[model samples]
Target: MRFQEDSIDSAGFVLRKDEVLTVILGGGKGTRLLPLTEKRSKPAVSFGGKYRLIDIPISNSLNSGFEKIFVLTQFNSYSLNRHIHRTYSTNSIHQKSFVEIIAAEQTVSSVNWFEGTADAVRKVLPYIREQKPKYVLILSGDQLYNMDLSDFIQNHLADSETEISVASNSVPEDRIYGLGIVQTGENGFIQEFIEKPQDISQVENCRQQDGSFLANMGIYIFNTKTLVDVLEDLSMTDFGKEILPKAIREKKVKSYVYNGYWEDIGTIRAFYEANLMLTDDIPKFNLYLEKTPFYTRPRSLPPTKINHAIVNQALISEGTILNHCEVHKSVIGVRQFIDHGTKIYNSIVMGLDHYGYFDRRSGKIPNGIGPNCEIRNTIVDKDCAIGADVKLLNLKNYTEYEDEYIKIRDGIIVVPRHTTVPDGYSI
Candidate 1:
């Protein structure tokens, strides 16, 4: 059942395993996600109620049998580091596995900070070089998907002549312009690469098969020697817009067309949409596998309860009590308390020392807060005392919502986590 080391051949092809290391890019500030990212880094954000965005790559590494992982982070790294320590600890006394968090400062350099993805790698080149891993696997921290990188690395090694291997996907014409588009030959040898081009229609038609173009999935594997050379050769370090492209010239740069469930949760809308995917009748991804498990520090609480509530397609964490409430297509974090007559639809509620809910109905309390209110199509931030029967929304029924705090985007109310609003006030 172990996918580790030498037992990783589902397709006979295997990768260079002697010195393999996985590095997760976890330092970026997700500005597009605004209010949510304002508090914490993208990788540290809560995902699927119980997991953080860092779990995707880390889980894949663990399941694929690559435990030597180093997450490179900068902003709000404390939370990410804490989570990793709590979940994938390398205490030496208990487990032999190691999944540690490394940052830009981990290197002995006067370099202010990791400038880009490439620069980040450059700063941490000492860490990788110290391990002397035969190959390097670079990954993103804010993506949502389940992948088997063992297959990817094995494929790369089988094509041993290949210098760099990148995972790509088939993106829509409109979405193509947002990603790095590549022209791969029938032999899977990538020819031309474009970054955020203006005209995607022509590019879409230029493709040979089914109007599909290969867009970068932000996943790359590089030979150790090749990586070192590129990191030293390139003045401005960045993988996406720089290193990989330069390495492809005269070098054996290959492409792996990935046809799996993958999503870039870099924005609030994308983050919200990915959670709703769990609502499907038969979900595209499942995290309930015993063999390829996604490990997390368990809350050690009992199962959640439902009493007179319509709970559909939601991932409710341990010790949650839903009494006469309606939570559909949402992610409720650990130990959350859903009071009676509350309706939380298409939202994310994170509950670990987070703020309580509030009602801004109408009072002199900064933002008139209320208690025990009816919530509908509204995202209430954590940690506020809401009064009974107070309404903080102005939708469908209520017309005059206070637009200063929560702006209505596409008819969805986004309540940033952990902001207090006084009771009895309606927004």
Candidate 2:
């Protein structure tokens, strides 16, 4: 449904603009997305050629008119913090609206770091309480979707009995193992919930009539009182693993089914596939939505200069210089300098952080994919220096391999951020 400027719900409830507080959970060590998360947090990890993973949820919240956001971050959050600070600025007149970052700190009550999702929010409860919100909208920092959160909130407000509302979507049986599955009765009242069940049969009873299972999208709306009560027990660390199931048994947790595009960028394969999918003729995650634009740190880079390049089905960002290159089915990020004779196919080149003027006479290799390089089925992270004649093709089809510079996970080569592959390097 389209988001309306008016805040009146169908149930005739006046949804206050300041009543819903947004809390985006920046993920933990991001172990599954390692190497990429080696230097930056999961949310800070770049995506869609120009935007970071964090931008998705933040943009959605802003578009939905819920601006009082607090991003809870812990592991490797410098880049994420910097990105948020630069991208989102609040109006001085509207002091109530802000996109603030709260990092994990050693408090007098607890000296340890955040254990899980619930723990992260629990530690920041004091700050959240200060917002004086009636309801709290929780989001994951590393997800991709354009949701009308105002509608999601309205659904929760529609039923006074709903203490918690979980945004869910149907997924095939094969995709249920890594997701939280929910069984719902009439009017989307959740009957049972299971988090990341190892055995498919564990959720056999939760399967829908169409053979798909209702999987939690990791988006939630909780009454302020309910959130505080559920998080009172410090032992309940994770929302999915510990808190959610317990709440499901006692509280009136409803499910709001989202039929739009949603993807959890949890692993290297998922990340690689999602970026490549953006190169599709009509991608599932549309970046061109006028009302719900994917917001990021706006750069004033010059338009991409394609010098006689044969490009097809690619999303090339601004300030990129493609010199006689053949880019097909790729997402080349901003400020990329692809030299002549390089061919990037089925890959994601997260371009340079900034343009560099290397003294060619100093025998220094610049920070970009040099000429005569062939990168296929790979992800070259930002600020990488790939020299000429380098071929990052997993020709041997190694499912898993790693070195100081590159890693092959699920048969896709990942050159970590700021890595430098010497001239004529091949893998």
Which candidate's TM-score is highest? 2
Model 1 regions more than 4 Å off: 7-18, 91-96, 106-108, 205-208, 354-387, 390-411
- Report RMSD (Å) for each prediction in the order shown: 4.2, 1.5
- Candidate 1, residue 148: how far the Cα is off, in Å: 0.8
User: Which tens-of-lDDT digit does each residue in 1-427 have in candidate 2?
Assistant: 4444448777787777788899999988999998899989999999999999999999898889888899999999999999998988642325577999999999999999999999999999999998899999999999989899988988888888999999998899999989999999988899899999999889999988899999999999999999999999988999999998999889999999999989999999999999998988899999998878888998889999999999999999999999898999999999999988999899999998888954345678888888899999999999998888999998899999999879998888999888989889999
Q: Write the per-residue lDDT of candidate 1 for residues 28-55, one digit (tens) a residue.
A: 7777766667667888887776788888
RMSD in Å for model 2: 1.5
Worst 10 residues of 1 by lDDT: 362-371
Query: What TM-score, over all chains together, does every model reach?
Result: 0.87, 0.97
Lowest lDDT block of 10, candidate 2: 88-97
CA-lDDT, candidates in order: 0.70, 0.91
Q: Model 2, 95: alpha-carbon shift in Å?
A: 4.5
Whole-model alpha-carbon lDDT for candidate 1: 0.70
